[model samples]
Target: MKHYFIAHKLFLLFLAKFFLTYILLTVVYQLYLGGFQQNQIDGITQLVSQNTQQLMRVLDMDVLVLKDKGASVMVFYKQKYIARIIEGCNAISIIILFVSFIVAFSGKIKPTLLFICMGSLVIYGLNVVRIALLVVLLDAYPEQTAVWHGTIFPLFIYGVVFLLWVLWVTKILDYAKKTV
Candidate 1:
C-alpha cells in the first residue's frame, strides 16, 4: 500500500487540489446566490445577458431586446418573446469547473493565476456568444430548440474547456521536464 501510494503521489495530490478548490468555489457560489436580493438579477447572469444583447446588436439583430425577469433574463424580438436566459445558462458553474481543473494541473503561481483569469474570461465570452447564438438559432428554428440547447451548445462549450485543459496539461508537463 505504501509503495502504491508513493508511486501515485502526484496524481493523488492533483485530485485533492481539484476537489478542494471545486468544493470551496461551489460553496462560495451558493452563498452568493443565497444573498441575492429579491427581484434582483445575479451579477454574472446580468453580464451575460448584456453581452449577448450587445453582440446581437453588433450583428444587426437590433430587433431583439433583453429584459430582466426577476431571476432570469428574457430575450424579446420585436415585442415577441424568443427565449429566456436562466441561471443555469449563465455558465458560472462551468467556469468554476474549468478553473478547478486548471488549478489542479497548476504550474507556477503567476502563470496559474493568469491562466485561470484568462481562461475564465474566455469561457465567459464564449458563453455569451453561445447564448446569443442560441437565441437567434432558436428564433429561426424553434422546432429544433431542444436539440440545439440540450446538446450542440453544451458540447461546444465543454469541447472548448477540454481543449484548454489539454493545453494546460501540456504546458505543465513541459515545465516539469525543464525543472527536472
Candidate 2:
C-alpha cells in the first residue's frame, strides 16, 4: 500500500485537487444561486439568453428572448415560442468543471489563472452560440428537440471542453519538459 501510494502520488494529488476545486466551486455557485428567489432566472441565464438572441438576430433570424416572473427565459422566433433558456443553458457548471480539471493539473500560477480565464470565456461564448443554434434548430425541427437538446448540443459543448483539456495537458507536458 505504501509503495503504491509512493508510485501513484501524482495521480493522487490530481484527484485531490480536482475534487477539492470542483466541490468548492460548486458550493460557491450553489450559494450564489441560493440568494435568488425560487424559480426566478439568475442573471447569468438572462445574459446567455440575450446573447443567444443577439447571435440569432445577427444571422438574420427574428428572435426574442424574454424572462417572465418565476420562469426560465423564453426564446421565440418570428413570434413563435421555440425554446427556453434555463439555468443549465448558462453553462456555469460546465465552466466550473473545466476550471477544476485545469487547476488539478496546474503548472504555473500565472499560466493556470490565464488558462482558467480564457477557457471559461471560450466555454461561455461557445455556450451562447450553442444555444442560439439550438434555438434555431428547435424552431425548424420541433420533433427532434429531445435528441438535439439532450444529446447533440451536450456532445458539442463537452467535446469542446475535452479538446480544451487535451490542449491544457499538452501545454503542461511541454512546460514540464522545459523545466526538466
Candidate 3:
C-alpha cells in the first residue's frame, strides 16, 4: 500500500485525469439540473405549502401570490421571487448525479462507490451554499437578482469546483512539485 502511494507515480497521473473528468461530469450535470427541475421544485413547494406559516416565520417574508403560473406555482414573497416550484423531474438534480457519476468513474467497483458517496455529500453542501447565495441576492437586489442567481453564482460555484479539482489533482494526488 505504501509502495502503491509512493513509487507508482502513474497513479498520480491517473488521479489527475480522474479529477478533471469529475469536474467536466459535474458541470455537465449542473447544466442539466439548470433545466426545469420540476420534481425537486414540486417537493419543495409541497413542503412549503404544508408548512407555509412556518416558512414565513423562518424567512420573514410575506407571501402575496400562490397562483398557477402555467406549469409551476409562482410563489411571491414580499413582491420578490420566494420560489417557483415545478411539478416534475428537472435538470438540476442531474447536476448532482453527474458530479457523483464522474468522480465515481475515476475508480470502478469499490473505489467508485466510496467516491460517489463522499462526492455527493460535498456537492450537496455546495448546492446549499448556492441556494443561500441566491436567496440573499433575491432579498438584497430584487431587480438585479437575475444577474446574481443566473450568472454570477454559477461562475463562482464553477470556479470553486475547478479550484477544488485543481487542489485535489496537484496537492492531494501528489502531482505538484513541493515548494515548501
Candidate 4:
C-alpha cells in the first residue's frame, strides 16, 4: 500500500488540482454571468464577436457584429445575419477546461505557467477563428449549418486541444523528467 501510494502520488495530485481549479474558475464565471445587466451581453461574448469581426475584415469579408435581444450578439455577413453568439459561445468554459487539464499535467513551475499562458492564447485565437469561419461556412452551406457548428467545428477545437495535451505530455513533461 505504501509503495502504491508513492507511485501514484502525482496522479492523485493531478486529480485534486484539476478539480479545484475547475471548480474555482467555474464559480467565478458563474458570478460574472450573474452580475451582467438583464439585457446586456457579457464582456467575453462581446470580445469574441469583436475578434471574429476583425478576422472577417482581415479576410475581406463583409461582417458586422451587433447586440441582439437579451444578452446575445448576432453576426452578419454580406448584409445577412449568419449566427448568434451567446455566453456559451464565448469559449471561457473551454478555456477553463483546457487550463485545468494542462495544470493537472504540470511540469516545472515556470514552464507550466508559460505553457498555460501560450496554450490559452492559442485556444482563444483558434476559438475566434472557429466562430468566424463557422459563420462563413454556414453562409455558404446553409443546409449544413447544424453539422458544421454542432459537430465539425467542435471536433476541430477539441482535436487541437488534444494535440496540445499530447505535445505537453510528451515534450514538456518528458523533458522535465530528463532534467530532474
What are the clash counts of all predictions, listed in order?
0, 0, 8, 0
- TM value for model 2: 0.94
How does candidate 1 score on lDDT? 0.85
Tens-place lDDT per residue, model 4, 1-180, is 999889999778989999999999999999999999989898988999999999999999999999998789989999998889999888899889988988888878999899889988998999999999899899999999889998999999999899888889888778456657
Candidate 2 per-residue lDDT over residues 17-121, each given as its tens digit: 999999999999999889888878888888888888888888898899888666598788889988787887899999999999999989889989998999999
By summed lDDT, which 10 consecutive residues of candidate 4 come out lowest? 171-180
Better of 3 and 4 by TM-score: 4
Alpha carbon lDDT of each predicted model? 0.85, 0.89, 0.53, 0.90
Expressed as tens digits, the lDDT of each residue in 69-156 for candidate 1 is 5777889865678888877888999999999998888878998898899889999999999988888788789999889999999999
Residue 120 C-alpha lDDT in model 4: 88
Q: Candidates ranked by TM-score, best first?
A: 2, 4, 1, 3
Model 3 scores worst on lDDT over the 10 consecutive residues at 85-94
RMSD (Å) per prediction = 2.2, 1.9, 8.2, 2.2
Candidate 2: where is the Cα deviation over 4 Å? Answer: 172-180
What value does the lDDT take at residue 2 in candidate 1?
98
Q: lDDT tens digits, residues 1-180, model 3?
A: 888878976657666765676677767755654674443444433443434434454676565435464545555656776655443312235345345434532434564455446555565456544554455567767789679767887776666556655654455444355433
What is the lDDT, from 0 to 100, of the residue 115 in candidate 3? 47
How well does each candidate superpose onto the true structure, as a TM-score? 0.91, 0.94, 0.48, 0.91
Which of 1 and 3 is the better model by lDDT?
1
Candidate 2 local Cα displacement, residue 171, angstroms:
3.1
C-alpha lDDT (0 to 100) for residue 124 of candidate 3: 45
